[model samples]
Target: MDNKIIAILCGLLTCFHLSTAFATENGSDSFSLGAEGIMAGALPPAGLYFLGYYQNYHANKFIDGPSQFYVDANAVVPRFVWMTNHNIANGQLGWYVAQPLVDLKVKINGLNDSNQGLGDLYLGTMLGWHHQNHNWLAALETVLGTGDYKTPSQTHLVRANIGKNYDTIRPIFAYSYLNSNGIDLSTKISYSWNSKNEATNYKSGEYFAGDYSLGYRIQPKIKVAVEGYYFKQMKDDKDNGKDIDFKGQVLAIGPAIQYANKNWSLEAKFLKETNVKNRPEGHANWLKLVWAF
Candidate 1:
């Protein structure tokens, strides 16, 4: 009787670990949401700028599965951009690199695990154009899977890795219309292509994602807005070249406020997730700082 009890307990524990991994494998990806809001399509003048971001995310419910699974993640990312004097088609040329340090934790059925390390590296270049009241931006970004990742075969029981162990390529486009009357509209769109995880023979699907914001300047240096984002997976995941049924999607919206001066700006936002599918239902809070240096 004692032996049987122990065996059953071990099996149940294993199931819980697999379930946790399932939550991450199907739903989460390399992209970070809520990274931009107030000036989604605007780039600063030709100079070097430093941007800092902090995000806190928490989820206690899962769609299409048990609600007991919980996830909490925090990240701090610092990005540097340099816009050069050279112009491309009447647009300023710029390049940037971002590195993120992430801490992630998950709990299910009273079992919990955590991981902390660098998440990924972002390398990109962009061109920004401006008209009287309109601004446009185009960029190419790449995600390098430089974070810590472990294959199922390498882990003792569960994979609590913080990285995806795959490369991703993306193209971004943005537009902004800022009216002198204090009304502003902005949007940023991007599509990603993920490569196969050779260690596990699994490949995630392609995804389309973007951010949108509408704001009214309450004062000369203050603005308030409603901001949101949408993500849709366009293809099915695959394992060993065969398709998997899981495809995740989500939409989130929230409030944002910003204060800006000639050389620096600060922005804060909170986003609540809804209409989430094949993923964890979560909310995120973000704080950003940008300075011309």
Candidate 2:
């Protein structure tokens, strides 16, 4: 038994242990679901815009196997977008960046741990088009492993991690159809390709996630909607070249409302998860504010 081989085996076990302890079967990736609700696919006109998001996520149950754990997490993210006047493929070109500050707490097996720090950095480029009653957007986004992270030891007892400590590249497509009668249907879908974590030698599976909204305008500046998000891992996670049977999936739906004016807009939603598998069954409250400059 070589020392290097033993060390590698220990690392893989620690990786799986940490994932199960955190209660996220996919091992906590950088993409956070339920971040977009109303007007999810609509891109603003050419200008600089600022968006702020606040989310409180609470979970008391973990499905798939019997588990006694609860998680409470809060995130505050600030994003900036510059929609340039330049055109690409007959659409507007946009660039955006987001940074998140996260506070996370977990109680598993009567042991408590917490972490508060910066999460991953997200940046993307998008091309948007608006024609008559249709809106379309395509984006290439990347999540950088810029947050605080450490590999847990073989003991598997470690502090809660707020970052995935890996890079992810996602391709997103969004569409919105707003009719003359103030009815709107919008959706944004994305696929993620994850890179291996250098510290743990683990690579998370690919994921397919989407957000959808259906709304009816009650006033010129207000709308009421039902919004939701869906997530599923499309591939198996890998640890040290061995496949891990970790397939996480969830669906959440809730009511949403938004108010918009010429300069700014605010939207809020509460999503309750259902049909969860290999993940935490939880609800999230999200509030988003966007203002144009």
Instruction: Give the alpha-carbon lDDT of every model.
Output: 0.72, 0.72
Off by over 4 Å in 2: 1-27, 154-156
Tens digits of per-residue lDDT for model 2 on 158-274? 457777778888888888878778887888888989888777677788889888889999998888999888988888877776787777788999999888776877788899999
Query: Per-residue lDDT of 1-293 in model 1, one digit per residue for the tens?
Result: 11000000000001112333232253777666667767667776777878888888888877875556787887788888888898988888988888877777777656567788877688888998878788778988888877777655433444456677888888888887887898768888889898887877777788888888898899988889998888888888787787767778889999999888777787888999999988778898988877777
Report the poorest 10 consecutive residues by lDDT, candidate 1: 4-13
What shift in Å separates residue 148 of candidate 1 from its native position after superposition? Answer: 1.2
Backbone clash count for every predicted candidate, in the order shown: 0, 0
